[model samples]
Target: MRVRIAVPATAANLGPGFDVLALALELQNEVEAERTGEAGISVDPGPGAPPELCDPARNLVVRAYTAACAELGAPADGVHIRCVNRIPFRRGLGSSAAAALGGTLVAAALNGAPWDEHSIIDFVSGLEGHPDNAAAALLGGLVVVTPGAPAVTMDVPEELCAVVFVPDLELETALARRVVAGAFTRADAVHNAARCALFIRAIATRDWPTLRWAMEDRWHQPPRSALYPAMPELIAGALEGGACGAALSGAGPAVIALVAGAPEAVQEGFMRAASRCDLRGRSFVSRVRNFGARVDLSA
Candidate 1:
């Protein structure tokens, strides 16, 4: 049997929520897995991607399949997987989650579909060691993970635009986690909680001004900024260029600008700021992808 699955890259912990509040972006990855009698895996690389990404064992598709076979009793023998990857790695994009979810979905579908959505979420969460990106990749749109019971998700305004700035260097999530403080004061927690609530409200209502002020956080960005020395200046430039709000998009390296209506203006501002710093990299002008992961069994 053959199955094809697609998952969108996520921008998680939007601002201050830390382990919650993930949003799906327009960037995506697609995986196709077919079951054969052999006991190996192969990946067909996407265009312009490095030659090494095509290796099955090193690929996330193989990791997902191996993990699923170990945990779900699915047959990993003779699985040929191919990936069409569009998301950039280590740029605060949920590239890992997208690959894991896409590969898992393909594996499960090929194995006669034993797990439900919630079960799949749990499985991927375990594989990724976190739920923020997995939840968004699985559920789509805006997902808020409660960390205890079943993860819950809500559909947010899809019309909102997100301007993402991807710097040249890679910012590893593991390294970013190390820089965060071990604990926070009760007052600080209260502050972030209040702002998180307001941020969600602003997202639901599509209120730009509310989001601009409500999304600022003291939890992770401040401590994490030492790695990216130009963060403050870049953020300030983004705001000056017309972004309503900007923040470290899940760990760092890439900063997402929340713009109300003018994406071009935001991009120009970000470009101008980068120019001033003599930095060069790729930037994405995209909007929220309300629809998360979708599979077509009929195909």
Candidate 2:
């Protein structure tokens, strides 16, 4: 039997909603798995996959597949996996989320296990140490995830497009998170709460003016911004170039601008900002994907 899984890339935080909000992108990673007569696992890495990811024993997909099998009380079996990766790794694009989902789905399909969406989310969240990216990758659309609760998904406006700027410098999530303060004052907490509420409503109602205010964050972005000095300029340029709102894509380095109409100005804004900072990077124009992870099985 064979199974094919497709998972979308995700952008988490969305400014004020730090660690609680995420949106799935049209960019995807595809994985194909087949059961083998032998009793070992093999993985073929896709283009741009890091050298470390090529090892089956240490790979995230292999670990996830093993975990899923254990969860289902199924014996570990031989499997061959081929990954066709497009999402940039470690750029806060939920590449890990895609890897985990792909492996979990492959295991479930092979075992004929009854794994529901929530179950999958719970399992992946445990492995990922956070739910934002995993929830967005699994459920798609715009997702709000809180611990001890099921992820809530809402439809993003079809007109909205994401203009992403990926910088050459890679920022690890651990390093990005290390710079943040352990706590926040009540005033700052209240401020973020208000903005998160506004952000949700603005997206739901397509209120561009309100969205501009909603994306203003005082918590994570400010502290993390120190690591990416070029980010502030990029965001300012995006807004100046007609984006409804813009924010750090995940941790640092990458920035995403939400736009309603043409993304030409937004794309240019990213390039111009990079030039001003004397940094080199690439830009992507992507749409919001309403569907999340999906799998197909064949005999």
Candidate 3:
């Protein structure tokens, strides 16, 4: 049996909603897995995929596949895997989430085990240590994840586009996360709470002006700015370039601007900011993807 899976890229923690909100982007990574009737795993890494990822023991996809099979009490046998990775790893774009979802779905298909959205969410979130990115990759659109609660997904505004500026330098999530403070003051907590509430309403009502303020945060971004010195200027440039809102995407070296106008304008704004900050980066213009991971079976 052969299984193919596609998972959308995700941008998590849109400003004040740290670890609670994420959106699926049109960028994607795909995986193809075939049962080999053997007892080991092999991989063919696609374009832009790192050479080290070809080793099954070191690969997230192969690891996820093995874990899923164990959970299902299914035979863990030979599987040949191929990856077509468009999302850059460790760029705050949920590449790991996609790989985990792709591999788990492939394993479930091969084992003929029934799977559902929540089950996938539970499994992947357990592996990822957070639900925001995993929920967005599995369910799509704008996802709000809270601990001990089912995630809620909302449609992204049709006019809104994401202008993502990805730096050439990579910031691993572990390193980025280590810089964040473990505790917040009451004022900081309240500030983020109010903004997170406003952010949801602003997106729902399509209130661009409100969204601009709602996306501001005192919780994560400020503390993290020390690590990505160019973030403040990049965010300011996006707003100056007519974006409704902008923020550091996830634990980012990559930033995303939410714009209702031409994405190119925002892209250019990011370039200008990069120039001013003496930073080098690439930009992508993308729309929200309303659908999540999917699987297909072929002989």
Candidate 4:
């Protein structure tokens, strides 16, 4: 049996929500797995691909495959895996989550795909160390995750769209997290909670005006601004260009913009902001993908 699964890239910790809300984009990482004579993995090669990303042994796909194989306790054939990745690494996009979800889906499918959606979610969440990005990758669109013994996800509206300005250089998530302080004051916590609630409401209602005020976050962004000097400028530029709200997509470098009207125009505005900053990269004007990971057997 041949299993091909595609998982969308996700942007987690949108604005003030911290690890709560995540948006899954249309850009994807595709994986195809097939049974071979022995238990091993194969990955396609490329000129510009990082050596770390190319190694199947240490790759997320192989890790997920090994995990699923261990769970099943069944061994018969080797696994041949092919990965086609478009999303850049360490740029605040959920490339790791996509790779993990894609691998797990293929593993389960190889075993007759017995595990249901919830189990898959739990599995991927465990592997990724969080549910926000994994949940969105597994079940796309806007997802709110409360991580614990068992994770829960609520599907958000598909009509909503996002604009992200991805910078050229990579900003490590660990490095970004390290810059943040360990604790926040009571007042700061309250402010973040209130804004996060308002952001959720804005998404639920699609109220563009409310979102402008709601998406502001003082918890992460304030301290995190030191990491990316261009962030403040991007936020100001986005608002100036008519974006309803803008925030750090995940950690840094990529600015997530909430737009009310035309996506193309909004994207162009973000592009202008990038140009102003002397930043060189692409801007993705994307809608929330309602359909998460799916297997195309034809592949």
Predicted model with the maximum lDDT: 3
Candidate 1 residue spans exceeding 4 A from truth? 48-52
lDDT of 1 at 241: 83
In order of lDDT, best first, we have 3, 2, 1, 4
Instruction: Estimate the overall C-alpha local distance difference test score of candidate 4.
Output: 0.78
| Reference-based TM-score of each model | 0.94, 0.97, 0.97, 0.91
The positional error of residue 246 in candidate 1, measured at the CA in angstroms, is 1.1
Task: Give per-residue CA lDDT, model 1, range 1-299, as digits (tens).
Answer: 67878889888877788888888888888887776678677678677566777777777767887888777776677877778888887788888888888878887787677788788888888878788988888887788888667777777675678999888888888888888857467877888899899988888788878877777888788778887776666777788888888888887678888887788887888888888878777678877887788876633
lDDT of each: 0.80, 0.88, 0.89, 0.78
* lDDT of each residue in 208-298, candidate 3, tens digit only: 7887988998888887888888999999988888888999999888898898888888888999999999998899999999888888998
C-alpha RMSD for every candidate: 1.8, 1.2, 1.1, 2.3
- Please write out the lDDT profile of model 2 over residues 1-299, one tens digit for every residue: 99999999999998888889999999999999998888888889888888988898778888899899999998666888889999888887888888998888888989999878888899998888778898999899999998888899998988988999888888888888777666457887898899999999998898876777899888888888788888899999888888999999888678989999779998898888889999998989999999898889999
**Model 1: residue 57 alpha-carbon error in angstroms:** 2.9
Compared with the true structure, model 3 gives a TM-score of 0.97
What lDDT does candidate 4 reach at residue 79?
A: 74
